[model samples]
Target chain A: MAPQSPSSARAALFDVDGTLVDSNYLHVRAWQRAFREIGHDVDAWRVHRAIGLDSSLLLESLLGDDADSLGDRAKDLHMTYYLGARDSMRPLAGARELVRELHGRGVQVVLATSASEEELDVLREVLSVDSCIAHTTSAADVDRAKPDPGVIRAAMDRSSTSGETAVMVGDAVWDAEAASRAGVTFVGLLSGGISRAELEAAGAEAVFEDAQDLLDRLDSSPLARLLSL
Target chain B: MAPQSPSSARAALFDVDGTLVDSNYLHVRAWQRAFREIGHDVDAWRVHRAIGLDSSLLLESLLGDDADSLGDRAKDLHMTYYLGARDSMRPLAGARELVRELHGRGVQVVLATSASEEELDVLREVLSVDSCIAHTTSAADVDRAKPDPGVIRAAMDRSSTSGETAVMVGDAVWDAEAASRAGVTFVGLLSGGISRAELEAAGAEAVFEDAQDLLDRLDSSPLARLLSL
Candidate 1:
């Protein structure tokens, strides 16, 4: 590849929920509550595996034909429970610092997730790193979600960076797979419940324990190396 | 572009329903019956635009959040009504001839549609050109649907052709937009009730009155010119 000019922008694309925010189990609980409220008992493992998917896709993935009547209600219930649970929301270790660190080093930061605008507002308030975030690609902005590359591609487009210039950091297989399929570099964090092996199997370039671990190892990470490219 | 050798394989990706089989109006009626049965009344015009989308997405598009109870049942109801209505389904003019013409010239033909396998089974029995078809990509084979490029990409992959070497022929704006997004050539047909202006606006390379008109003009069409490249 030809050397990129300094003017060519670079992006650090982050998946909001599990990677930076401590919300994987929270989502699981919320989904459980929603399902129970809608008169269904979905397995927590299935919902965990579906963490990074859009709500509709998640419901379809888990319940398949059984989610018909409960689709909208389940989502509404999850959102309600989740919103009520938001007071307990917190960023994973160094989540805000990592975004700030990337921004400090002139890397554009973009959050690529399937959360709706209202949901993102809550997440943004919790993360408190809005100034560092250059752009956000949400589910409402795209027809589909993670593992399909639509959200990641949208983030790349909004960040004005090509896939090769973006490093996607997340804590789920969907994020890793989406980045891999989109030809973007994928950095994985174990801040979420997903295993390192799973993330790597999904095509993560590097895996860290959490945002703080990634931040501490930034000098040796793909984002730092790519910037120096 | 470099010239494609005569031996280099090419593919014709046909979107069933309105593009070849004259079932767009049939689908609208089925959807209307299903939605009405589920207590919502959606217009036929709304159903026309949602033709190329996946069934779950179609319900969401028409009824919005009101499609919760109808998502799975609406599909079941549509399939039930549609199966009964299949006696009227027939391939559009020259549909079989066009598939045969492409196959005669050594170009593989693949069907790219969001219809379920059961629905495709019904559509295939109606079209009765199975021997000429190289492969078929259905909604069940993909994680997402038209306008997302999953089905088109899957068709190209199944047919062993790159997007540039594949031509997507359909009769809806969603089909045109999907082909455009996938970087495949798009040929639009007007039999599906979508206007020529709409298809062209969505980036169709050529528009025909129907499949027969495309077959009659095949020698002068982009599909022919590309195959000869």
Candidate 2:
């Protein structure tokens, strides 16, 4: 593998769950079941929109005042349910190819996700492009997750890249907000069940249908513009 | 219950799955599992977008050329998976109240959905507003489902309402299209994870966050205009 050029290198930071793996709905289901187990009957669509946030933030956003008392048990139940269904998780189309292509182009590719290290390992396995991942940042590395900029900043710092030369690809509004806060360009994908309009409202500069669509349009995409820069 | 005055009576038609009940993601999961069971790996987001269409149309839309061979088995598997998860389905906030309010105002309330009879029974149970629902059209009542206008028209017919006096509330683009085709006004909800822009582009005159938001703003919504008319 060729070393990234220090002076003019660009980086591609990605959110793993919905952005690369077809697991957002599974996460939604897990959270729904977890909430139900803890005597809270949260809606699935509500949980779907909360998938990319840090687990604690997710529980708070969904449970509100109840989160103070029920968050820990809900989080534990979520992990159990999520892991039980992990075998069905698959990579989004062109996920591995997109990562490989970015790495092959000498761009620093980092997995920037709010998933725990254990969960990240499973996601990486599903994505099956770890060799192309130059660096990664998990929930453990940050005190706050998206829409906090901490995770994005951590990924950029680990990749030794600046925001001007980095672009974040993600499937949630939280990812767009995090990228915006971190001064990185945001590219959104609709594969996470988030709408393009919502993504744009959250500051996405460009939007694609999914990983395959992004890969197909890479030459004309924001990533391509970054590569040219 | 008082009979609706034909001279000024209006109707409110509703799409069941994502519009009233929080089951779109569950339907996405069911479709995903069903496809996998039949040796096809359809993405959940893809299934999510196809939720409001008829089963055959959904299979065709997702599987294309292979749908001819695998559609029936996939449909059966989908029913089994969906039924298994039906217990978790819950009505969106204010779903029943919205129906009851409309019905109490002397407006005809119709449950217009592409769901099968059995599935509709489960959804109706979840919403628990059957008394307010004067009529309903399941898949058995229509040869073709939404995006084809058959189901919406069936609901209108059953309610003894004309397009000019009725409004269709839904959470998917297909519902917008079907309402447009049926010549009924379309109101959109964001509860299904579809974007407002997409719904508006599909011909929704107004959009709300969910059933709760719509109910909260009923006096200022398109439904209010129909009430006055």
Candidate 3:
């Protein structure tokens, strides 16, 4: 068989925090503050690497056996810190245009995140592109988070899309892992601050600089080809 | 941190079989043959998607618990069948030039693959760019194959390069996943027949249409920037 092209995609699943919004670094800071408040000091980059992971798995992957004892408290603390940090949250450049363009092209656009409903509301408020999204899957909708493939599956399911016709856009390794394991194509974006090499190694098919880069390349990008635009 | 540019790369780690040589389809066919000889039929894309996985993990991922019973037999069958399929193997377009170009640019080019020494010998013979590769790490050098990061680490170790100064180029998600976890930057090639989205999602900072496409853009490529040229 020849190399399969991007023409197979029909639905676009976007990982919100890092991919669409410039919140990954804030999440890293929040996690750090949360851990620090609990008398633990963790490296920022290590926290950055674990950004897209489900809160529980993120704690476990980073804390190892210690997670069992401290996960819940850290999660709560992080949430509190994040709520205050929300004011700094903003959609990445070209994010609104990219989503609106996908919608304009008749592609089903869905936001998939482990964020809670209230947090989702905040993000939606900032992006203000609610009308462009066809569906959304939040932490409450997914029993498991990324690296488990369950959230990706749930996101795809909500849009009635299959792996062959779906593409996941994320800024972290966890998002790529989820999309890869779920058999969906994963497109990586650098807007979230993840390195390209890290993103590629996680399983991105193609990567863009950010939402604007993707939007600018719509005519030449795999996403445009996938949408058959 | 901002999106990391590929300027940090000082050496290039290349995955041979599928990345440089056009052996990915042959792999899919071999697995299909081995599985079918056992009376089970799986999709070609399914087999293709699992190509870069370490052989042991490939079976476990594709066949689940049932692989525990049939793995040894399938392995034997695949080896037998692959020996015959080797005749069809060829280096991908510009594969040789890409290696030579990297070498000429003073970048340490190393071949990193899980292929056994014997299998790797066959691949090198066909690629015929032996002088371009500064180092090689076969399955013998690493206890864990790709997707485990050990092989990637071993290759980088031989060149005395750190993750920030190393880049991995391959055609599969497993290669990307391995590089991502190892903290190395990963560039992806489409010559292996994997989709761009899948490559990017797996964590490729960039994905070229093929080795030729990569060479064509070598002047402005991450590989060039990685070498500080």
Who wins the TM-score comparison? 2
CA RMSD, predictions in order: 18.8, 1.6, 22.6
Question: Whole-model Cα lDDT per candidate?
Answer: 0.80, 0.88, 0.79
Of all true interface contacts, what fraction is found in model 3? 0.00
Query: Candidate 1 — which residues are off by over 4 angstroms?
Result: A1-6, B1-229
Residue A187 deviation, candidate 3, in Å? 0.6
lDDT of 2 by residue, A12-110 (tens): 999988899999989988888989888888877788888888777888889999999999999898999998897899999888889998888878899
Return whichever of 1 and 2 wins on lDDT: 2
Worst 10 residues of 3 chain B by lDDT: B1-10
**What is candidate 2's TM-score for chain A?**
0.97
User: Model 3: per-residue lDDT, tens digit, A74-191?
Assistant: 9999988888877656677788999988887778888988789988989899899988888898889878888788888888888777877778898888888988899988888876
RMSD of 2: 1.6
Candidate DockQ values, in order, are 0.01, 0.74, 0.01
After the best TM-score superposition of candidate 3, give how far the Cα of residue B4 lies from its true spot, in angstroms.
Answer: 42
Could you give candidate 1's per-residue lDDT for residues B1-229 as a string of tens digits? 2224534768899999888887776676677678778887553334656787866678788889877865888888888988887765767778889888888787888999878888899999988888888899887888888878989999988877887678999988788888988999999987775666677888998899788889899989989865674
Give lDDT tens digits, candidate 1, residues A113-177.
88988889999999998888889988787887877899999998887788778899998888998
Better of 1 and 2 by TM-score: 2
Q: Return the lDDT, model 2, position B127.
A: 86
